[model samples]
Target: MKKIIFILSFLFGFTSLYSQKLSSNNSKAIKNFNEAIKLYENYNYLDAINKFKKAINIDPLFIEAYILTAQVYSDLNMFDSSIVYYKKTVEIDQDFFPNAYMFIAKFSYMTGKYEEAVKYQELYYNHYKLNPTQRARAKIDLNIYYDALELYKNPVPFKPINLGPNINSIYSEYSPALTIDDSTIIFTRKVPVKDKAMEQEDFYQSKKLPNGNWELAMPLLGELNTPNNEGAHTISADGKILYFTACNRSDGQGSCDIYRSYKIGNTWTKAENVKELNSVSWDSQPTLSADGKTIYFASARNGNMDIYVAHMQKNAKWSHPQPLPDNINTARSELTPFIHPDGKTLFFASDGHGGMGGYDIFYTKKINDTLWTTPQNIGYPINTHKDDAFLFVNASGKYAFFASEIENGYGAYDIYMFEFPKNIITTPVTYFKGIVVDIDDNKPIIHAIAELFSLKDASIAGKAITDIDGSFLLPLPAGEIYALNISAKNYLFYSEHIELIEAYDSLDPFVKYIYLRPIKKDQIMVLNNILFDFDQATLKPESYVELEKLYNFLVDNPNLVIEIGGHTDSIGTKDYNLILSEKRAKAVYDYLISRNINPQRLRYKGYGDTMPIADNSTEEGRKLNRRTEIKILYNN
Candidate 1:
């Protein structure tokens, strides 16, 4: 009997210990085969292969010689040659090596022979009864082979353009995070450590030029980059706050922990460990919601890697991390979760979910706060047998950025962008970007808070603070009405409605140059969000959102007395409009009093159609005329 060994991947292995009668009776062939085993064990693959060939040539029916030769080729990663020798063994004796079929299937799939891979996988199952794990893997491989075949026939349009030399280098680059406007990009680059044989990960950034080219990338400016490893991060929509992963630092709660940094006036503050969101297990690869209130990341706290989410609390601390639903996280590993700016679709990479193979990118839609639709594979060539991960789609849902090693890439894992496939794009998102200036002085209002409220439940959809330049940006998901309120100390809060419920160009965003009025007498501000039923004094349910804002404003400035004035369109009689407007104004006044505002501080009046901000001759003008306003009466 001749001993033969064939080592496949860690998932499978095979060895021949059969007691069948010798197929080769030649003494010279037997001697050559024995000598070949020594060279193979010493890792002299080519020499061993030559000796195995001599044995096969001397005795054409030598099954052992053919099997060993095939194993050598397989170990050398020469799948084509391995397949040839393995097939020779099969031809020489069909029952000699049953495991040969599985190897053939694996190598065939590796070499892009999907149809052949499927055939051999099916043949392997017919010949052998596998253990549970092997059986599971066999089924997954079959699904992958079949899916790959179909995908090859009908490929999605994918032309990945490299981000160019300015943003890439001769070292690995990945984990790209972009600002809402796509004007700035920050990513991780792995560079060789001086005087060391290892690489270190650090943050790098580049700004998009007016001509659409990227400026030369430089190490991100701040104390955020340290001697320790830092990578796998996400940026807030405004590009002011950055959340990233750092490992083995003294402050880390886990082997890898998430940290945060702030970009203030082109200089990033020192990173601080986000201890509330960290566990005593390895955690990395964070993605944040557009609001910067919710976060998703990969953690190995439960043994196998899974995606976990945490929310920012009202007290400005992170909530305890919770694992995502089982549909998104399987017993197998999942990683690189990216929540789109729309805040409805979540993209991640999972090996547990059956797909082409390895970690395939999958997307699941957020149905609500606690539920998500079952994940769907983003589909074929975009996800191949290799571990494809770290995908990011822009707000317009037209282009995606990822990192991959290409034939002519600058180096390992260079960043690339591709036109997002239409079939898999999430709902397009738009952002509200503007500067908040003092209405009187025209100076930027720094550190002002902007809160966006959803009209459906009046929930805080997003929040941002104005930069030193008085600029702010926040994402708006499609097809929803939003109320934006911007406020600063000793200043009347700015309020407006953003109606995106109807279809419009999502790429064209809302740009408002907000002017915050100073708190003084005669400073009148329209309450655009306050609404009433047609031809009636009853306030609509949606009106309570603005009413709450009024109550809070009054509470914040206890000594201020204001008049809630209402007006109506010109179609009605003056008496009818005046009476209806008076009741509407009283509705706001009574509601504030009900919420603890002193009645002495409140007054109500109706100006009928006397104060028309626009032409009441047209419907648009009439709509603008039918509004409520807050007029400052006293500030003592």
Candidate 2:
């Protein structure tokens, strides 16, 4: 025995004396590993990873160190590193096989390596029984992977069809918005009104029935309607809130401001203006996102109407309104926006991008969090040479509803529904027809000016002159209130505020009848009421009231004017009657002058006995001819 130099180069340097030193080093390594564990527990994963790496370097064979280091890498989302270390642990000790395999499976799933994840998951499952929580989590991940695989393999076929009369009506009804579950629907309907006094448009709504046929349409109740005009409503996904436009009054912030209302049970509460988003310019046509976290609307505040958006903050307040990205809003008008249920596609009507003629339906798809692609025109058959706006699509991404003019329509415009194919849809249209007559006589009032004012934009939108039969036709946007004014030369200004909340589903045209009183001499009419005075060569203060009526009449007629002549009773000399009548005629001229009536708009002449209709011999007859008369001098 060569002195048996048992130079024990202990495999891990564990000579009895060296064992103490090795234990000390192990303790140091253990201390470092424990510090890293503490960091890992607090979720300081990056720092913990550094500490774990240092500990493993000091003790290359520290099995526990390798296992925890792999876990720390996994916590930091370094799945590849976690897999490498986990594999090393299993290689060093077969006993750690199952746990290593399970971690590798989890990491693979985290990295989207679904096939590898499934293979390792099977191995883990074969050796270990997972608790309920682990099983549930694993199942969820599996389902996600399966769905993603399916999505990648084949995209779902999107076939859009036009919702026929089952949901739409002849009167303009469109801009359909619905709740997330598709249980409720809120849409705009431009229907005719019964006894509508103003020239403004009309709109109404209908609900879905159990059998899927929409129930008879009804106008929205409560204070949401006005005689002015209101429509283009947007309902939140829950169907609990509505936003619309109301215009033509002193309370408006501008031409129109956005308004909101909340549904309480079957009725809606009073609507309040969305002042935060309104400006001195026009604002209308609001559309809310499916999540109710964003609002899109049209505004003319920047001189031309364009689309803008305001985000809903977590605190329930709206953020400052900002113009929509360049892809959506342009210099031209962009209105009637509809955000689809998927919250990834935006549909809107735009005149900026060239289309069929007027505003055409277009769509844009969201590419990423802050990016959207250029819009695509919903081409040909769906659009036409006229204005085609206010679109609504159902939950299945099929079936659309909109407003259009059809042959033999009941009124100027009507709502229609057709099979709008995902690829191509024929233009569908309808109309609402009715007549306007004297409310008292039931006879049609001719040449009466009918005006429709939008309550949302607070401005006059459309006007029509009654036909020879006192009948007029008007097109309406759905879900709005309108103020109708029907004024004739001698009739009291006929006015009626129409609320279209109930107009939808009411299969009849909005029948309107107006009564006009005659204006003649000795009618106790105001003379300044007639724009004249006794012996004065100037117009009096009260003259404007009557002259304004005349001015408005002229304005409405556009091509009508007359000569105003004056006469007197023969209670004086022939020279006196002629001279007196002439003075009276000039007096009438002076009166019109003060009222800003154009001199060229009138002619004046006096005929003493020349134009008398009654005998100057009797006081009654003389009084009748001692009058002022306006004869139509020009008519176009």
Candidate 3:
């Protein structure tokens, strides 16, 4: 009844004259009222409104005509005139149109007259009997309006800036997705297809200008687009892969199926259905993890539309989809799940959970693989009593982007970003980017995984794989030191220690190049991270991280024997340097032996001031010269 009342209140308020004769006996007034009803039924609202006013002028007591006039005005979006007619009818005779209470309440509620709406709503329910569904909805809306009051009282401090004319157009733009660095935004734009009556949605992208404003959006020039619609997409943190929604396609498994495309250099490959994740129902609105190993999306496969997640298997396949926990997915619809690059925080929209009403934006933190904390609303103002979903945030967590059909927009809907206060920002992150190539031919190495581990605790921090171009980016929590190990089949593992504690921002990407050497003899590489006490032979505790990498390499190649060579800068007497370098080399050999490596397979040697790879005249060069290196001696 609440929904019907809510909608009807906006339509025409009417009297309970179902079995009675016309109350107004004026023949001309009755004729005009009948003509007005026919015009209203045919959706000629302006003509119906004029006829209704004519009937009222002839018979001022025509309450039904007054109700019809209000309905026409409301249909025209003239809420003030609509409310005036509704109130005039009430003043003449409240009982003549008891349903007018509900109509007045609806107009009041829409115009920020919450208290008046509530007052009139109570009068409506008390006067009429409600069915079970109506009562339940009424109760829910009542509580929602009360909550909305509180939300309006205390709003979150946000500054939303329009993306400007370059990005918006006379057509609708919505469902904005951004790269980890916020350099590009892809959105869906509805445009008329020249001669066709039906509008089409296409994927459009806007590049961020040097001044930071987005440039004019253009349809994707690659084969990712077709005559059919393509929308609701999320870009991988590295901006290499796009996951999106396409409906009613021949290859689709349901009404809407999730599709993906890979970025080859600057062009996107053809779209392919994510067959593993799609079902015979709706499966759309996908979000890819920062590491590109997990997919989160909304699906109705489980009967109720809920958020489901799947993992990227070791063979580069998707795992079986599993619905999120009850905390995140309720019996009602839950959609638009955006897992932030940090991987712990999740933002989505839900109508099932208790909210201000309709679908409201919410956020939660993943407690573990199968559990998440109860969602908290992104807050009022940002989320109104209408449907609001599809929110994306940058790696820095400073701003959030979403679509809105707000006033003064360029068209139907425009994308906007809100600067979030510190309270709502998630954990800060810094992206580590690099390219992987084969040293033999300088060709790109695709699908190589870069595993990041925390040196402080040896915990796995994050992972990212090289794209077709051998370029990779990993978003790690800022202010930490990590040990990054790159792995690929039939290639020797590469290890490096990175310290990003001083990089307090996520905007500037840190780049490093990795040259993967093939598994061959005579391959010599430096372990510049191996450290020791000042001029002493004892290894520092932090040096164990690099030693562990050596240990693993040895364990992975059991039959191989390596000579651990230590080099010293020309800082002391040659004789003294040789003795110290030999002890440092022995320290590494001893650690490997302790890790169960055969003592006979390892050899320790010192080349003091004899094999300096860099100039020992400068402090930086001297630091690089005092290092540990490994040489492939034999593999049988």
Candidate 4:
């Protein structure tokens, strides 16, 4: 009763026939047509195409031969040849017009001729009311075409309606695999099935109806539906076979193994565990490339869950799984890898590096046939503090589908849809810009420490020092929130929060201005905040945490340095105050010493309050005046 995942595809079948009676006049035509069928069955579609043309030439009205030839040319990806023969078939026999229209619609859709495809599909439906099954399938494909049209022509806001009780239960259900034609949807459902004492998860599927709703779901009964967990599946592009994950059992190679099932007639044959894939650890979340030649998935056998890929051999056996390079997988988890339909981009979830949260969606592009560039964060709005994974983008690469925990969502994790900004979706770039200044004067303040914190985790993402003109620029992947902190001594710390939500195709400057206030004695301040230790000439461990503010102030104004002086009230003997204050002043001097401040740039004196701003009679006044003070000795 393990969860059995079924990946289904929609397929339409047509019949082929040679000339019924071999009359002397049709003998050469029959011979050519028979040879063409043999070549078509063997998948020598291009060669079979020429023979079919010869047959049609011998008998100008060989309609069935024309239909078969068009199908073969379509399979060979020669859409122009396919369209010619299909049109010719209908010209010879008007009764075959609906079938011809269907082929033309499909070819048009494949070639991105949406308007033409829609026109032809509508014609097919109007001329011939197909059987219940054909109509059901046709409606689903029509819906897909319409969806594709909406995705391309308009930037329609996405409103994801929850599947509700009919499709979702307390159990899990996800990872939908659709046929290229979109007539059928196969998704994984985890449902508890009872078998004597034990209960386990099992896979079930529902078919689309002519009315656009789904039919009642039922289990896929076959050898593939085993008593062990079998979920996470993918189907080949042509819709002939399914590749899925099956857990370790008496028949499995390891903890979880990849398996495949071939379609025969109307049912799937016995499942065959892919012996070439499984290792001792774990391997799952399989995805097949659109061409059906490459398979990508997650595996922990090489240590953590990293993405790996395999190739389909000429004989249809899979090669050994090869781990993706370091650019894609670090010594951390990388899962739910998806190879987009475009075949150049790969999207996956990783915690390795350069991310906003624990797990964020990342992508890498194949610069050429063999080279993959560095991975990049997809960015905010689409990514959040919570996990954002399991991504799928359509052929046009406009809208994308992923899971998120949006407010009022249907479940703990509900599927959400989003669009990449038109510019970034087309072309992408990196780099950020901003400005810093003094709060009181409103003048630019250079050399302020600007630390960037990731809003996803509130961790320090990066740091940059403002330049001479009080401007800073940093490189960042588009789509994120960052906290910028600017601080300098004798100045109030400045903070600016920025969110880069919009996608950009080229370098876009994020104009920002920061203001910092001057620090003075009347201003309430945290003392240990400035760091000084007890009974010691050496600065405390925590000293620089605050003193760095002073250091930065000096760095910002190279011609400026103040006298580091310490004062004390009458609590101690005047001699003791004089000597202790000298030590305290020197401590500040030495601490700045360790920081590479030139001795020529600093000086120290112990006044012991020969000049006291507050009365020593009160404890508060004594505390205030018996303190450290820095006066600007020089300013340029």
State which candidate has the highest lDDT. Answer: 1
Give the candidate order by descending TM-score.
Answer: 1, 3, 4, 2
lDDT of 4 at 405: 50
In the range 524-621, model 1's lDDT, one tens digit per residue, is 98998998989988888877788898889999999899999999999889999899899999999889978978899989999898888999999999
lDDT of each: 0.87, 0.61, 0.82, 0.64
Ranking by lDDT: 1, 3, 4, 2
- Model 3 lDDT tens row, 593-632: 8999999899989988899888999998998888888888
Per-residue lDDT of 1-636 in model 4, one digit per residue for the tens?
011001001112322122133222688987897787677666677787889889888998877677777777776778877888877866776564466878777777666566666777777666664777877767766664564454345533455555444455555656666543333456566555676554455556556577756666566656657776666787654344688887766677678878888754346777887888788778888888755668899999977899998877868688988988888888879998887644567888986653444577888887864578888767543554356677766434555555445567555544444565443244232334557887568788866766655556554444556666776654343466655556765575654445566654222445567666565433322222333444445655544444665566567667765678777666767887788778888887887878888889788888765767678999877766666667666555
TM-score of 3: 0.75
Models 1 onward score TM values of: 0.92, 0.39, 0.75, 0.40
Q: Superposing all C-alpha atoms, what RMSD in Å does each candidate have to the true structure?
A: 3.0, 23.7, 6.0, 24.2
Which residue pairs show backbone clashes in model 3? 1-134
TM-score winner between candidates 2 and 4? 4
Model 1 worst lDDT window (10 residues): 2-11
Provide the lDDT at 86 for model 4.
78
